[model samples]
Target: MRGKATVLLVSFALFVGGVLALQLERGGVRTTLLVLVFAALGAVAVRQTIRKRKK
Candidate 1:
C-alpha cells in the first residue's frame, strides 16, 4: 500500500517535471537536468515496485 503510493507520487513528480521541461526553451542544461531527474525517478519507481512484489 505505501509502496504503491510512493510510486504514484514519484510518477506525478516526473510528469510535472517533464511538462515543465517541455515548456522550457530547447538546448539548455536545465532541460537536460530535468530529463535526467525524471529518468532517475522512473527507475526508482520501477525498482521499488519490483522489490515490493518480490517480497
Candidate 2:
C-alpha cells in the first residue's frame, strides 16, 4: 500500500510538473486544461494517501 501510495504521489508530481511546463511553453487554453487535469489527479492522490494512512 505504501508503495502504491508512493507511486501515486510521484505520478501526481510528474503530472503537475508536466502541466507547468506546458503552461510555460505554450500559454493558452490547452495549458489551462492540463492544469485542471493535473489538479484533479493531485487531489485524488492526496485523498487516497490520507485514507490509506488512516487505515
Query: What is the lDDT, from 0 to 100, of the residue 55 in candidate 1?
Result: 91
Which candidate has the top score in lDDT?
A: 1
- List pairs with backbone clashes in candidate 2: none
- What would the TM-scores of all predictions be? 0.67, 0.51
lDDT of 2 by residue, 1-55 (tens): 7877787777777777676667565657667767777777777778778978999
TM-score of 2: 0.51
lDDT of each: 0.79, 0.74
Backbone clash total for model 2 is 0
- Ten consecutive residues with minimal summed lDDT in candidate 1? 22-31
lDDT by residue (tens digit), candidate 1, 1-55: 8967887887787778777777777777767868697778879867987887999
- Model 2, residue 18: displacement in angstroms? 11
Clashes of 1: 0
